[model samples]
Target: MKTGSLRFANIHLQEGPIGLLTSSLRKGRLSQTYIFAGARSVGKTRLAKTFAALLQCLEPVTGPDGSAEDAPSWRPRPTSDVVSVGSAEDAPSWRPRPTSDVVSVGSPDACGKCLSCRRVMAGSHPDVTFLRPQGAEIRVAQVRQMQELALLHPYLGKWRIFIIDPADRLNESSANSLLKILEEAPEKVVFILVAEQVERVLPTIRSRAETVLFQNPSHHAAREAIARVTGRPADEVARVYSLTEGAFGAALNLAAQDLPVTGLLPLREAQVRFLEDLERFSGQVQERVNEAPSLEAALAVVEDPDLLLFPPLLASRKSLVRGLLLAESLPAAFPVLFSRVFLDVLDKARKGLDKVLETVIARQKSAYAAEILKEMDRQFGMAVQNLFQAQVVGLLECLRHWNEDLFHFSHTADETWLLNLDRKDDIMALSLVRGLGFAESGIQLLSRSLELLSRNVQPVLLLEHVLSSIGGRTP
Candidate 1:
């Protein structure tokens, strides 16, 4: 309909899947549904979005069938034929001869800058949408919405494209909901579900879509490519590679986190306060509960995060752990360590129990208090599930960087690229108090903690030991 101004960028390290899909498009053999499964950070989502852009590009490189490559005219409605890129031919190139030029995309290419491509890349294309699990699972409500929208005609492009990332997150009900959509989607619509593991996805959904596989590129090549993007020296790249264990996403994040080391001072302060308050107030809360004759008489001192920004609430240890895996993550995670989990419900239960001041009333407080604690325990259990926690290695890496920067700044006091710029004075003060020696010892302690953690040592004991050892020595 319109001329494509977009060009495909050779950004992925793994080009096999790209070439496969592009060649399929040229041959007019695209499928109605595709399962682009791969390891995390191998570019499945990136490729999926790029493909959607190509489909919506104003100037599409016409396929062997009858679509126009450079046609200057317009076709508001797609010919009820093409999917994102199917394998079987829809028709021979025998439609009305186009007045404009037609060039086949032998290699993967798109006029990425065109109006259509731009909208698609920006994720604003009327015909394209993305879906991912909001929390632990993709609910049936989400799939139902997708199904309803899939039946509609394209608002701009000839077809509608739905990209579902980490599709395995669909629980049983949601997966069933998705399966129905896949089984009955229209010819002009396309579904691309990207997943890291196929077994987690329902087999019926898998059966309906063509499974496309992607693998990690060699670490040497991945590092070089990452270095190009980061503009870091070879040695630094090597360090990142080693830290990330060849994961490009992790490596990129580490390289980009070159901020002032003092930015974590507030978060560090919050963490200490939270831990101290948690330990300090629990006994008082129990005492108040025991003394109270009725629920109306209970009160207690506790932690809250009203002063912090909290959306998608930092109420779970998994979320807290994830948020703290980077220096950038500390503020979010640190507040959560003090913030109430499931605050709305927890508050309702607490108020229902006639308690205020965030008291952890003892089970002996009466039936109401026991019920409140029971609910708290249930919610807390859910939050502490292993599935939600951030990787230990990630947390360690972030801590390692924090202490490393403090050590470097203590002597050099350089701010070329501080990770915690906001806490410059605090960092300087800490450096003054502990000096370089204290920092080096803190780093060693953290390293030992990581080593013990990796070896499956008791997490609570190891953490307590590390905290105790570093307690007075740190700022």
Candidate 2:
């Protein structure tokens, strides 16, 4: 294994799976299909790609031909102990040898410098295909296309590879189509199905493929791996590690940014300010509703908060109405436009934070000489694109944390689990005012909104719906 190779270097904390793969390669016992099951962002896909590259590498390093003595560090089990692929056995139970018996070897790996390896890593090899969800599914059409391609011999490599990412996203039709391929895949063809939830995969498909489990690395291990890659301070890497919820890929991305970790301070402050405003406004609305004599009067009082009295009300009814139209359906209390004001405040805050980020990037750029300014500008451009999304994500994360705290606190009556300890009084008051059901529902709504955001749904609509539902829920 070449340590300098991206294929090897990028993989973290899956020595067992890697050793099994290398052993199979060394013994010429590669399975036609494999199910790499693991949590998202845990390098299953990365290892799959690396394996694909090795399978097609023009200069692979499989040590002395099929000789156990050549590689003294590890040895395969006897034939009697090995469950042959496609045998009448559970996929999960099939193991070539105990992982403890398999050790890492310096051979049976891709020469990442070879042309075939480079092409595979770059995702340009004709024989290597990556099938991902086409707008939320691996459609039947996509699978059929892959089937056609799989029939052909390797265009320029030793084996043809098809990697289906998030294989659980395959709908019934597509999954059945893929099942057909797995049943009788052509010689020299490899199918790697990467799924986060193996249970969601079809039983037939799971039964056909040899399953390789990839476990999530410990946080401390992840922090050290990311630090080694990013060469940043341990504290900074740990902070990014926690912020990304132990997601290795996301942490690496954040660490790779040229902007210092402290550069996010302004963004955090802005999010905190916006959230505070929302909390304060929610309290005021609840107070006004409590004072009203009837539901109608309460709606009227909350919606028509006197701008003179509440100097911080930044959005007008017209703006609120415009924003509400973005949502698929008007919230139950459509007339309660006060909640929409928070959206306006959030927009202003985002724009202000954008400026602050731009200034920071500019200062960083200034440190570079003119010759590299073009490269710096390109890097900053990418950073800017990520910054806008990060800002929205950051706000949503805050809300998510708050909602989670509320839900857990309601269930357990424990303050230790609360992420925002400073907001204990507000959380307690809201819990009392809204009840447990609201907290649960709020978490679901936030979760759905976050998922939609990832799918490129309009952020404006998501924000509008969340604000209206959470802030405008009648007290």
Candidate 3:
């Protein structure tokens, strides 16, 4: 969350990898290629950038012993304070200050004030390049282009750093091309491949690189850090931590958005009340089934609209879902009621999309022609579709957690292990009614739905199938 500086000391809870990289730099054993592997938002990319900056720093801070130290925290200096490292004609005649006057390199950190350091931090460095997925995959052409760039000398720094984020996104041809570069990488060129799921990376590429694994900080550490940064109550930050499952980046993002932690309490209370109503309704349905003269009557009783729909609960659930979506902190174990909420959003967006497109076209028509307008409309539609798909994926994660809780609670009866602690009674009742088999089936269904969703299955159909199957309306 700290801006301006990318020093290793500023990074939270990544001491091991930081030490390794800094030591390697000090000992002149730095690897040409490194795979920084970790879960999403655990500081892998930040560390990569920092390392790159240090490698290319004009006047890297080093200790008396010629090793990097835990450097002092850096703040952005005025443009006048930035020390330029350029050609002799334009560069200032500079010399290193005495060790006592400079920061001690106990292991060397970037001064973060030099022209090279500033450019790298601001993502404007000519020699530093970041390669991300062009669409869903990093294409072979990108790697080929990078290969050409690699053959060139560093533009303005000591090293040419190429960072491929989510390196697992490299498709087969691209990965092969990257492997060739790694095999015979040019001098002073560093390739840092970052991956959340390292297993997805090609075996040859993984084998060629030195891998540094990053782990998430403990919940307590993460909560304290987030609370300190956001200046929010520890208790409030704790709730946000739980919602993000201890991802520091995600917690910071939610805090930046001023997540409605207090409002969540009311949402939970509403959810509990709705579940109680549902439990009671289930009892009534059972009684009706017992009294019914035939299977058709019993089935009709179970499917009644009044029994299935709780209008007040639906309204409360919709508001809560929308708020969470806006905050980008939708809770794990988000209730199954999200199916109805998602359908509602889908319907509204479908109805309004054409009108929204027309408005955009009208505003742009003076500047763009018919073909441009048509292409813009197509892109806008794709963006909306991608947004809807992302929402479905988020909801699927929540349902996955819900089903996991059901499975665990059914086996162990341990509320402490459950993500939805507030929904204990509801989960217990549902577990008993649906049984362990249902929980297992629900988990499988959600997992499959997620996999299918990645293959471009219709989001609406996926939700409908999941809701119906989970509700015992489908086999």
**Residue-pair clashes per candidate, as listed?**
28, 1, 10
Ranking by TM-score: 3, 2, 1
lDDT of 3 by residue, 1-475 (tens): 4343866656777778888776565444556788899886778888899988877777766556553232322211111132222334533222222253333346566777899889999888999999876446788988999999999988898677899988999999999999898877775688999998899999978776788999767555776777776788866665555455345766665665544323333445644544443344334444554565543243344333233232233223433332332232334334345556555655554445445445545654677677756654554455445544554575566667667877988998976666554445666766775567877887899899999999988677787666555533123
Ranking by lDDT: 3, 2, 1
lDDT against the true structure, each candidate: 0.55, 0.60, 0.63
Per-model C-alpha RMSD:
14.0, 16.0, 14.5
Q: What is the lDDT of candidate 3?
A: 0.63
Please say which candidate is ahead in TM-score: 2 or 3. 3
Q: Pick the candidate with the highest lDDT.
A: 3
lDDT of 2 by residue, 1-475 (tens): 1123535434677787887787675454677788899986778888888988877766555333323234222222212144243323321121122122112334466666789888887678899899876444678988999999988987897678899988998999999999998776776688999999999889989887888999787555777787887799976675555445346766666667543222222222433444564445445544544555543243334233131122122112211222332234544554234335544554554455345434544555545577656643444344334334443565465566556767877887775455444345656765665567877887898889888887778777787677667653353
lDDT of 1 by residue, 291-389 (tens): 655433332111111111111121122122222332232322323333333232333433433333234344444556566666444433332222112
What is model 3's C-alpha RMSD?
A: 14.5
Give the Å shift of residue 425 in candidate 2. Answer: 18
